[model samples]
Target: MRSSYLQTDLLSEFDRLQQQVASLFGGFPSSIRSDRYGSFPKLNVGTTDDAIEIVAFVPGVKSDQIDVSIDKGLLTISGERQALFANEESDDARRYAQERYAGSFRRTIELPANANPEQVTARCSNGCLMVTVAKHEASKPRAITVQ
Candidate 1:
């Protein structure tokens, strides 16, 4: 029937449009996810009146194993995580399922223009790696004097 033919054509057109839209978004990851979803450590970036705070959740990694560096306004955090079952190295003892991520990973964050890398400091405690970048003297908010 003529009506059935038009409906089929319309459905096919919608399917094609959907495929095109999905393809367009396929190249970009969602905001909540990264390119390598399980590779990099999760991070929280915030700011205070005095400094910018970057906290990286790095459980199971020793403080000495973690490295933090700032170069050209890019802050980098690199470290390694050991496997949960290193002693079970045999094929028969292989884990049927493992969700934990274990390996070397590196994450880089872009610091704001107000960030002063020279006054940066890093500390790791309670499985959190906190990096603080002081704000430039001129960047801090100032109250104007009223005559």
Candidate 2:
């Protein structure tokens, strides 16, 4: 009997911990949490001697809706994802069981020191935004022949 009670208590504790973690990440603003699973948009910023590359994951959004810009070393991305069911125009509020997220979101990233603002090119392909900032001629790596 004691072992059964201990097992039940452990299960309850586990449930509470799980709920806490979910709530913590669930409240993350839509700007960062683009994924339906409460995961934030994943971004990778890398540098290769001549350029800097940035990739952001943004799903369920159209290419036309997204706007990307770079200013003063700041890369900003903004967009609005219209609600999926807004067209139905139903006023029923009792049918909701699970709602992940919806609406506008914006994210800003700081560019690297050698990033050339004017040479940045961005493209959105299959829900991922890829931005490449080519370095200026002066910043590109040059081979120094060791005599």
Candidate 3:
């Protein structure tokens, strides 16, 4: 019986430690993820020969609501997602699960050294914000002929 009790205690301690580690990294795992979980509007960054592209998936947000800016090698995206049921009858309604994040959110990304902050452009369509930053002329690759 004493051995069984020790085993139980050890199991509980292990479970607690697991919880702590998970929280330290981020909240409970979910289908949706981000650079920092719970941060609105997940984005993907990629580079091409002449430009860097950033696409932010911001569903349920309007193009007018979003604000994109670049300053000192940092690109920032800010916007708001209004609640879906803000005007609905809430007194009698109950929420079973709430996963969608609403309200204002902002995400800042550091531009690469080759990025040309002066040549940034952004457009929003189909619930996604696409930003393209041209690469500096000095950093662009060039083909050299064999001597």
Candidate 4:
């Protein structure tokens, strides 16, 4: 009975450690069902002297299917990815694994305080969404000449 109790405790501890590791790696896990958003696209954020840049990786999504919007200092990207095996030819195939993300997904990113929502621009090219938000004039750095 004591050995069984020790085994149960070890399993619980292992599960806790696994969850912590998953959270550290941007919520990615070994199990398919662990994703809270159902395998949405990943993004990269950066900033230039004048603008903030965001690139979202959406391989199967089209330009027209995506919706980009900014409201109250939040940038939202939403779209739907149709299933690849929708056609009749795939109906008879036995599916062993499906790791791709299908269906609708929405991701919201918070804009910086200096970001100018009015000067935002977004374009989709080569399965990536590039969004640029210009910084406010008052927020940009200015040089003062020494007299």
Candidate 5:
């Protein structure tokens, strides 16, 4: 009877430990399902009739500073952000200055199997980086007439 009580206590302790761990990691995000606060350059993905559209909100990043590439059905976007020092006094020092972000950032996105790498297009404008991946010819929807 004593050994059985010890086993029950051990089981209860393990259950409590598991609950504590779960509560600690419950708020942690899994992949892109995040709320975008912890993610840099939040992404918007959508599918059109002809292509898969992706937009990365990259404010204060220049077109030249951005790099986009695709290989093995994985699209990668990487770049470095230069630090900005704004507002200065007579001697060249700021009294109150805040820097939101700086340095290198890299993000990878998995493309669909039907996405044609050759038809990929990327453009940066108005603080947004837009990427379009065209679908394969055979994967596109088409109308068929019944015989």
Candidate 6:
């Protein structure tokens, strides 16, 4: 009877370890199934002497479908990239997976205190969205002569 009890306990421990492994990786199938698609767009932000530059990799999305705005030092990039599957009414789900972040995306980036939001400019080229936020005059570096 003790040997049977030990075997049962060992099995339970193995099951628990399997669950821990799955959760450590990326959770279970149920968790993945409940996850949502079309997350907010990602960006690469940097700065220069004259302007703060932000580039977002958003391929397969047209320039007309995107909207860029700035409010209270927050720059927002929003867009939608429709799926390009050829099937008009095919019943097959997972048609090309549609994983290119389709159906709307929004990303807000905080601008520095010296950012000149009024002078911001945005352009999309070659599947990348580039935004230039001009820096305030006071923020630009200047040489000073020491007395």
Cα error of candidate 6 at position 69, Å = 0.3
Candidate 6, which segments miss by more than 4 Å at Cα? 1-40, 86-98
lDDT of 3 by residue, 1-147 (tens): 999999999999999999999899775655543234447888899999999999999999999999999998999999888888863335566766556777789999999999999898899899899999999999999998999
Return the TM-score for each candidate structure.
0.73, 0.63, 0.77, 0.73, 0.68, 0.68
lDDT of 6 by residue, 1-147 (tens): 999999999999999999999888775545543434434466799999999999998888889999999999899899777767645335665555433445668889899999998898999999999999999999999999999
lDDT of each: 0.85, 0.76, 0.87, 0.87, 0.82, 0.82
Provide the global lDDT of candidate 6 against the true structure.
0.82
Task: Tell me which of candidates 1 and 6 scores higher on lDDT.
Answer: 1
Off by over 4 Å in 4: 1-28, 31-36, 87-95
* C-alpha RMSD for every candidate: 4.7, 5.7, 4.2, 5.4, 7.5, 6.7
Model 5: how far residue 107 lies from native, Å = 0.6
TM-score of 5: 0.68
- Residue 93 local lDDT, model 6: 54
Over 18-91, each residue of candidate 1 has an lDDT whose tens digit, in order, gives: 88886886644434433434546889999999999999999889999998999998999998888777654445
Top-TM-score structure, candidate number: 3
lDDT of 3: 0.87
Taking the tens digit of each residue's C-alpha lDDT, what string does model 4 give over 14-111?
99998898789766655745455554878999998899999999998999999999999999999898888664236676767556778888889999
Q: For model 2, name the residue pairs that clash.
A: none
Which ten-residue region of model 3 has the weakest summed lDDT?
29-38
